[model samples]
Target: MTEVVHYALVIAHAIESLPLSRAKRQLLSKITDLDIAGRINGFGGCIAKNKTLGEEVGLAETTV
Candidate 1:
């Protein structure tokens, strides 16, 4: 589960670094967020609830 979250974060960071349009970036971001949230929930945790991207990433990193 931790590895899954880490992988999702890595993918999210990669997406963020791409020179994409704002709309496309946001679409990818939301998709990544859903993936991460689902992974965390499957792990019997809910760290992503109401958290900002930075906050969620921080939690994911620490958990990993």
Candidate 2:
């Protein structure tokens, strides 16, 4: 449950960090959807990967 919330925040932050452009918005939505599913299914190391992705996109680091 905590991990789900953490990943949700990371996804939200990633979406918020994107430019306010339609194309980027759509892309972010799709990307986050997939990421969330993958994380929920225990596929990708989503928490760490999302943190890295957020940093790469200039979002501040957040505690999980």
Candidate 3:
């Protein structure tokens, strides 16, 4: 979920020339189920990195 939010924000920012509502609608229209599944798979890597950083900083463990 966080990765999706991050991707959406980055995509929206990249198209900042467009109006906010249009940009969001356009971005959402382009997304497909496969795209979301791929991102969800990739989120494991993000979680692993976050866990490593948390360990280094002596923070509690987290999970997706």
- Backbone clashes under 3 angstroms, per model: 0, 0, 0
Can you write out model 1's per-residue Cα lDDT over 1-64, one digit (the tens) per residue?
Answer: 3553333344427787999876567655765667677665664323444345435344332322
Determine which window of 10 residues in candidate 1 has minimal summed lDDT: 55-64
Tens digits of lDDT, candidate 3, 1-64: 3533424123434444555575343443333333444465654223334454445445444620
Q: Model 2: which ten-residue window has the lowest total lDDT?
A: 3-12
lDDT of 2 at 14: 66
Give candidates' CA RMSD values in order: 10.3, 9.9, 13.9
The runs of at least 3 residues in candidate 2 whose Cα sits more than 4 Å from the true structure, single-residue gaps closed, are 1-17, 45-64
* Per-residue alpha-carbon lDDT of candidate 2 for residues 1-64, written as tens digits (9 for 90 to 100): 3544334335346676766675456545655776777776766733445466545545544521
State how far residue 49 of model 3 sits from its true place (Å): 0.5
Q: Rank the candidates by TM-score, best first.
A: 1, 2, 3
Which residue segments of model 1 deviate by more than 4 Å?
1-12, 43-64
On lDDT, the candidate that comes out on top is 2
lDDT of each: 0.54, 0.55, 0.41
- How big is the positional error of residue 24 in model 3, measured in Å on the Cα after superposition? 31
TM-score against truth, every candidate: 0.46, 0.43, 0.21
